[model samples]
Target chain A: MRLWLPPVLLAVLLCGLSAGMPALEPLFHWVQPDKQQVIYERESFLFLLQNHLLLVLISAAVGTLVAVAGGIFATRPSGRDFLPLVSQVASIGQTFPPVAVLALAVPVLGFGEAPILVALMLYGLLPILRNTLAGLEGISPAVKEAARGMGMSPLQVLVRAELPLAGRVILAGIRTSVTINIATAAIGSTIGARTLGDPVIAGLVNGNTAYVLQGAILIGLLALATDSLFEALERTWDRRFSPQVAV
Target chain B: MSVSRSESSQLMPNRVIPALGLLALALVWLLDVGTIQPNRIVPGTGHGLVSAVGWGGAALVTSTLAGSILLAFLNLRGRYLIQLALLGLSLALLPLLLDVFASRHLPEDSPFARSSIGAGFWCLLFFLFLMLIETLGRLGSRRGLELLLVVVIGGSWLIFLQSEGLESLSLVREFNARPAKFEQAFWTHLALAFGAVAISAVLAFGLALKMMRSPGWQRPILGLVSFLQTIPSLAVFGLLIAPLSALVAAFPVLETLGIRGIGWTPALLALVAYSLLPMVRNTFVALTEVPENLADAGRGMGMNERQLFFKLKLPLALPVIIEGVRITTIQAIGLTAVAALIGAGGFGSFIFQGLGQAAMDLVLLGALPTIALALLADAVFTMLAASLKPTPATA
Candidate 1:
């Protein structure tokens, strides 16, 4: 199977379902025969999908940048003293569940998109930070020495040698971070951020099975599509870079 | 050369403690240490460090932080021990810091008046703990020592909270109102999270064993579990409700047994489904990765396949399997909170209820315990895995 095929297929299906959801009213009517309104109409599916994707994307971008920078600094000579604490914090912080983090944020930051975004960014950064630290530290000393022997400065070695070697691991970290943020952002609707979870929360609040099914199907497809995209990206990175490492 | 240089640098003044100290000092003076509320719903007036705890408290806080920084810079022999002692004392005494604020500022006129911790106190506590953790790491402390420190600090805080001095604190006040309900929520949360973990562990072990015996079953099984995992928890819970309700409708006897479309039934099913990926993956990897030579040695010693399987592979696999349990338990505890939306009783019910009521304190009452539980699970499982691992010499 082609690497890109699955994600593309999933994406198309997700889009089609979101766009054509109202067209399937008869089917939903069968599912919820007692209900007068079988379909959720508080917010359009496409709009919620966009809002959800935007939240996840923005958080993933900011989290990747901040976590990567912090990871880099901790591994550097000047910041080495902070390494133990930083790495410890990264690992320990993850033990606090994302939902708990979201709940805690509302008290400090107040409810709405801001608190959820802050929570998502903070919580989502952990796995990425951990991966970044591990990737950078796992590089062989001999490899660094070789880079230095070839007249690379510390910065040059870092930019050229360290980062390239660590990039795959860092990407994997971002994948994990994005995967988590997607789910958390869906739950963010409860805290008042418009997301795909809105319909499901609405459905659950009122006895509407059709609404629940719509949201669940979309969220599931989005996750699948995003995950496959990452898989394809990782495969491409492996193909391009594994040859160099092997030599 | 680099190794010696790195070693020598270890003797240099520690940066982490001082950095944390300076930041905590700034935050304590800069932000409000506590707030005074008229009642549960009313927003409170925040009091800064000096105003809230008075000059004596402020002076004491400043000196302690400054002393920590000084200690970090002193380069004395066994400074980590000194730092650890100082930090641990400060952390254990932290609740009393709030007690001081509560006593100083709480209105005597209104019984409804309550005190809540402000951002500054949280910052101070957080930094102190961070500094303590850094100190512990620097000391290369044993797990036993770390656990003892936690127990000591945790015990002190528990004792202090139970005392009358902190009764006006919002979190405690929230707890006092619904003590029975709180207990029920605690038990319900534990039951759902652990119940799912227990069930999934058994199912995963069977699945993993099957995968071990037959390669063909591996991909599909893993694929199915991973697919389940990738879906959001809310989506899974939502999806489970329809089918479950239909089943209950179809079979009226199911309702008597407490199997319903919504509630713990769907919650547990969703949790178990979500847990399979980690549990199965870990068990499979652990069993497969057991050294072959050890198995041959067991066979040579006249052990039968069953004996060798249990004695060799299972023993070696136990730690990794426990690690999976660690991961699964943490995930389940969190998801169980989400399950409250489906009428499943847990800490999450408190969270969503609080969220609905727009009660920040109530939210804190819910969220804090959930976090504590997850952290506790993490620590317990980590220790279990560590203890179960074969030491280097034995391996």
Candidate 2:
């Protein structure tokens, strides 16, 4: 029930801002010129929200696939030697900022979603990869031995025992990757990929506080919603995994 | 038996990867025509690699092919020397290839007809990178070989910097055009990154200590910092603009002190805000991770709360705290580039300008230096964290 509070509050704030509530006008009053006021209505909030969600979803899905593949490969007997290399590559991926990636990628991939997608995927890779690796490596050797003793093949053990145990941690990584990508995706607008960042960029350029606030508030709400949803999912996972363990 | 199998497999040279790489490079050079193109002045009308570099290019290609063949035959013991030599030769070929292409294809006075690095060039670079990685893996901890390679590469880069062959490259031209501006931007970038780190360290440490003392404040303070972390940097910059402007308008004195809606003031504030989470979280974990028995022992010895904190908690937590500092500093350095969007002067100015101009080299000119700075900061902080770490007690 407490989880609903954030979204409810966010909805109310959005409504008030969209309605241009007199109470909220003072918040943006400083942005006005002498004896003049301006209201921002440049882009549709719903459209921006959808665009932002789409970018995050696409990037997170791709990043998850790549990171999980790399993570799984590194944990394998033959591939264990590549763990340090994989980890270093992922860290370097993160160290280069998403904006720098966008800047560099724009030339090769050209502008729009391609470059932004590349940036977000690279930016989102580290958390998912690191967490996935950690989660897999954290599994006890006893569990593996037990599964093997029960006549399970390596693949069967991995699927039935190992992955299930690592599921929550991997899910947490995906959650972190997706949530961070939500904010980082805003940079996509700089390279002509329209998202919630349009207003933020527009406001920065034109000095329209209303536009900035509107975009920021919507993005903040979206991030909060995503975070809370992940929290709820985590709680559910926890409940399922250990009924005896108290919340 | 498994160990022997693995050891034997490891000892056998992995020639396939490097050979495959060389094959790709050879195929690109031979079959993939139009590898060198005139800089995209009028879209795409450039000659093939052979015509671009003429006879000298063929000789260079043959040499590289021979080197790769030699690399495949050589055992692990003697491979490092050959790999190092091949790597140096490959590095030298880049500028030579460019220079030859420019001289052959483009007329001397036709500035617009400059040679551009093409798909073939990129393919060669990819091959070189693979070879370097493979060699590094095989060489293991031959520190002397690594040092010699670095010195050779560094010396070659220095020579490349002075050579006119690189003059036609757009990145060099951009640098040559605005050397002073680039210098200023570099310093400004350094200042913003380091200055923000210094301020955030103090604030984060104070908040962390406060949160440690008061359990009630922990949830709210940590939540707030985490929430702030979620705010995209641009949005944070935007959010700060109005309030900061209003503050300057109201105070008037702040404006005199160089506080304004846009620039370093907001950039620094946003950076400090972003930095607080990692710093506070690390500090909190570090402080808590210190054994309760130690603190209790300190208290039992008649040490006051202040003494317990200063003498026991802090010293124990210092390494982790320094780790946090390292993380925050590296993060801040990377982020300061974004701060340029808000009129704050930094390397980002060049990045954005390059973006506007659609100049890849200009973007690189801004970006390369920023990446170098982040790496430098990372190395320095890593050393600091290592030196500060408490050594394990002898048995």
Candidate 3:
């Protein structure tokens, strides 16, 4: 039922971004390399796009590893101590705006992807970490006891038993993180790495809203599309183990 | 679930970690001072106050130690005396650390580095000390209320009184010394924040209520808001510019209506759009969470939907609704600063100025307030949230 809203809206946004853009390419023909290329290079939008997959993949990969590990530790009585610390830290990340992180990071990392990466890492950690913690904790102890009594190794039990059970929730967290990462990545543009936010910043300066519109709509569409895709994935995963709904 | 007994037991006086960390840091310092048996055994002090990683490590260790100390203290007597002693000791150590680092030739003028490093140490200590105190006697209790009144009145008075000499604070000085242009810039920045929050609250509540009461509309509204949430703030600004420029141009009346380019109108609109989803989503979830039985009972008792919504659903959802506003408020303040990129002004005045001039101080003027604003907003909202909680049945 929820499948259509995001993608359809995204398509409309992306369509307007590309098709409705003003024909300013000809106006700047005489100065510098073509406007598009010059803007592309200057804004470094291409550079960000070039690194987009790597950024998303790395953030997701590390997030998955830490979150899962943290989740395991969190679910145990003995290892429960770190949960408050990690979640508190996560809330701090959300509460303290990304601009603050970017400001603080500038001196240490000295700008570019390092600042973006660190901010993104902090921003992305919460959902995945919290959800991993939540998902594992949500599992009934009886289910785990039954598995343990059957002689499943801890590793096997986690991988073949608990993880599958927690997959849907964990994936939801990843989806949250991913969508958040895209928005945080726009802050990257403010610092000069340039992703979808380049045109938006340019538009602000030029007083041409379309440029901002173009980039914003694309990024929005990207986030929505990705989110919708993840939601679809979530449903599919949820259905696999829940027999009543699966049939 | 309650924490284990092991968690509670760790709160006792063996708060050995901070003392040991300080000892290790001192040892490192002595070696760096050429006072050690083996030079390698002496940790070399890095230029930026014991090095970045070391500072961060020390902070983490100290925070944990502090946390453990608080845990231990809650079950002890004379906790205030204990905390006072710890504050005095840390205050005493700070000057020595400052001297050792001063001799090491780190920049004394580096407030960010120094404050951040020092704050890292202090916050963990403060939080550790206060967490137990807070949880043990949280706001609904009589003592808690007294403490609250004292702290709030004291804190507010200090800030208000201090506003007289706000320029004395180095950061605040730069803020005050900025030109008229920056002041103008600040007004626009404030307008954007004020406008965004206002619009977002209205839109969010409207949409939230609409979506919550009707399941048929849920997916689409959630998706729309989610989609709105996904849009880059910068892009929203970009998208609005062309259409708005033309619309204002056609009307001419709108310019008189206070519509302007790359200024308050569009920035406010962009921020409003950005801030909406969180509030809407939060309010809807909060309201819908009202017990189904209660709502059904209300209807059974002859309460119509409107009456029920106003009297019951709203009051119950107030806490979460306020929470969502808190998030949006913090976010809007930060985003409002970004509106400076378009020449709509506020603290972003200093941020964009600093960016332009490559002057970090200018950036700090804007950036620091923002951080403070966010923290203050969070603290105030959280306090309010505490007070709003239903009174516990003392029984």
Candidate 4:
């Protein structure tokens, strides 16, 4: 029963914010003189929300797969020597601003989801890769040796023992990557990829504070909701792993 | 042991393999293919390709080829001095090669017909980078060699700055057209990056210390900062606009003080906010990571809490705290580029302008400098942190 609290709370908060946006119109009017009571008219909140989520989901999914694969490959005996190089490349990817990536990608990919996806994937790759690498390395060698002694193959030991042990850390990485990308995906609107950033960009351009507020509020809510969901998952994983019963 | 010695002697630095790959690419693609092509406004316009041989770049090409061949022979010898000399020659030759290629190939009177650098130049630059890394790796302890390389590179760049040939390059053309604006943007970028770092560092230090004193405040403060971190810079800029404007409206004094909704005030605030997480997290970790036994020992010496913190904990944590500052400062430098979106002038203004104009070189002009700044910041902070680290004897 306690597990449902976060989602319920997030839903209520988001719904309230969205519904109350019209009432808060006067507050936004303080930003510009002409628009006394106006709401952002770019796209409906729900539609923008869906678009934002889809962008994040696609990027995070692709980013996680590639990063996890890279992480695993680097940890393998034959590939261990490349770990530093791989990590360095990942760090470089993170350090390059997503906006810059977007600017560069737009000319080649055109102004659309493709460029945004590329930028988001590159931006989100580091956390997952770093955490995955750390998680794999953190595994006690004795645990692996015991598994091998039990007649498990290397592949079996990795899939059944190693990955399961590393799941929590890897999940945390995915959470960080996904949540960060959720906010980042907003920047996609600058290049005409329809997302929550549309209102913000529009407000910025047209001096419509109401539009910016609407978009920012939604993005903030989305980030909070995703973060709470990850927290809930972490708690569940903690319960499953710990031997001691909950009080 | 003999086999190991032979292998070690025979093997070139690992970086050379990639260098060789780049050289191979240069040989196959760049030698026959165009080194520069006339930039076209219309898509798919048949601009004539100017190969290195056709563009009077044969001297540079021949030299580079000969240098690579020499490197291959010297690789087996594996002597550090020979490698260093060869590396120095390659580094010195590269800028001259670029200068010659640009001067010889690029047309002077045609503003419309810009000569874009082709695949060959890119391949050669990559090759040079690989060589530089390999040479640096081999001469790891020779800081003088690294300094010499920097001086040589800077000297060549200065020469390029005054060269008539470089004016034909699109990036240089962009700079020449708006030199004053470029200078303004550069200084603005530096000021914003450094100002945000300074403010955030102070605030972060105070907050971190407070959190340390009250253990319960740590989690909430960290959580808030991390939450701020998760908010995109664009969103933060958007969020600030309304409230900031309201503040300005209420107090005309702020407007008089240069506070506005879409400029430096909001940009600085956002940059400082974004910077706080790294600063706070680093300080918190550094403070907490101080060994309990060390603190106990200090206490045993009759030192009070203030003395213990100032004398022992701070000195030990200084390096880590500086590391935090480094990360925050670098991150701030990058984020300041995004601040240009809000009318806060920086290098990003050029980037967005270039993007609007659909000029790739102009984008590179803005982006290249920003990247250089970030890398420079990283290098400087790394050196500072290394210097601050206690020696093994002291530890």
TM-score, one value per model: 0.98, 0.86, 0.74, 0.85
Measured over all alpha carbons after superposition, the RMSD of each candidate to the real structure, in angstroms, is: 2.0, 4.3, 7.6, 4.5
Q: Can you write out model 2's per-residue Cα lDDT over A87-171, one digit (the tens) per residue? A: 6556655666556766777755777887888888887878899888888899889889989999999999888888878878999
Rank order (by DockQ, best first): 1, 3, 2, 4
* Best candidate, DockQ: 1
Give the higher-DockQ candidate: 3 or 4.
Answer: 3
Candidate 2 ranges beyond 4 A from true positions: A4-30, A33-37, A242-247, B1-10, B15-75, B78-96, B112-127, B130-151, B291-316, B393-395
**Alpha-carbon runs more than 4 Å astray in model 3:** A1-48, A206-214, A244-247, B1-173, B179-191, B212-215, B296-307, B391-395
**lDDT per residue as tens, model 1, B296-334:** 899999999899888889989999999999999999999
User: Candidate 3 on A1-247: residue-level lDDT in tens?
Assistant: 5655666776565555445434444432322232343232343433444465466667777777877787787666665544555555556556666666566555345557777787677667778888887788787888788789999988787887788778778898998888767766775666755577666666556544435555666666666667777767777776667783233
Interface RMSD of each: 0.7, 2.5, 4.1, 2.9
Task: Give per-residue CA lDDT, model 4, range B71-162, as digits (tens).
Answer: 65565654545656665666566556556656665566666555454445555655555555545554444557766777887687778756
Q: Which ten residues in a row have the lowest lDDT in candidate 3 chain B?
A: B33-42
* Runs of candidate 4 exceeding 4 Å displacement: A1-4, A11-33, A107-110, A242-247, B1-105, B118-158
- Docking class of predicted structure 1: high
* Candidate 4, residue B186: lDDT: 97
Among the numbered candidates, top TM-score falls to 1
